[model samples]
Target: MTNITFKNNPITLLGEQVTVGSVAPDFSVLANDLSVRTLADYEGKKKLISVVPSIDTGVCDQQTRKFNEEASKIENAVVLTISNDLPFAQSRWCAASGLDNVVTLSDHKDLSFGMNYGVVIEEMRLLARSVFVLNENNEVVYVEYVNEGTDHPNYDKAIEALKSI
Candidate 1:
């Protein structure tokens, strides 16, 4: 179990976590097309997993847009914005925001992505705001779990870490 606080109240989650230097857990997430996409789908490419509570919130939307913008300049890297939102909602948000570079994956079906990644907010039925960067082998090289639920992550550091890989 992992402990996180929301609105100054402690919350507990149930799951083993993916940490820095840990091999990323493979997950079957729903894609914009409603097709199942596993970690292997991004094989041979650098990956950035942007985990957010929900895409409907301001912070989550900002994180997704920031990553989408940065993704265009990173060669051989795929930025995946992950959340519990439905694929249709993800598609709409991406289209509305002109976020073409980032791939938004939905974890609404089984919630295994959140559970395995250790970002699920058990009490709220949401994901914790976090980011994980992985190499082609799916080994996590960088990780950031934003302590504050409403805060954005340090994108510059995350990008630099990815560049170092």
Candidate 2:
């Protein structure tokens, strides 16, 4: 039960919270094409999993854009922006932003990623703002469950963790 907040109101989260050194949980999500994507999709590559409640929000927009910019310069790595938004909306947002580097995934259908990562906001049915870095072996190298749902994650630390792997 990871305790977080949205607009100063305490929010409950579902599932077990992952920690550094733990094996990253496998989950299924939908890509922009509506195809199922899972952890195996990026096997043997570093994964930067950026979780957000919704992509259309101001903080989410910035987080995705920032990760997109960073993803382009990274090699053998995949930056994924996961949200509960529909695949259509995720595709549209990526296109409108011209952010082609980061992959936008939708977990609205099953909430697999949300529940596995323990970022699901029980009250609002949204994922809390969080970031996770996984090594090639699917081991979590870094995890940040933002205390405030609207605050920005420690971008530098997450990127450094990915680079360190």
> Residue 126 error for model 1, in Å?
0.8
- Give me candidate 1's TM-score against the actual structure: 0.94
Q: What's the residue-level lDDT of 43 in candidate 1?
A: 98
- How large is the C-alpha RMSD of every model relative to the true structure? 1.5, 1.1
lDDT of 2 by residue, 11-126 (tens): 99987789999999999999999999999999999999999889999999999888767766778888999989999999999889976666999999999999998888899888
Positional deviation of residue 72's Cα in model 1 after best superposition, in angstroms: 1.7
Q: What is the TM-score of each candidate against the true structure?
A: 0.94, 0.96
lDDT of each: 0.86, 0.90
The number of the candidate with the highest TM-score is 2
TM-score quality measure for candidate 2: 0.96
Q: Tell me the spans in candidate 2 whose CA falls farther than 4 Å from its real position.
A: none
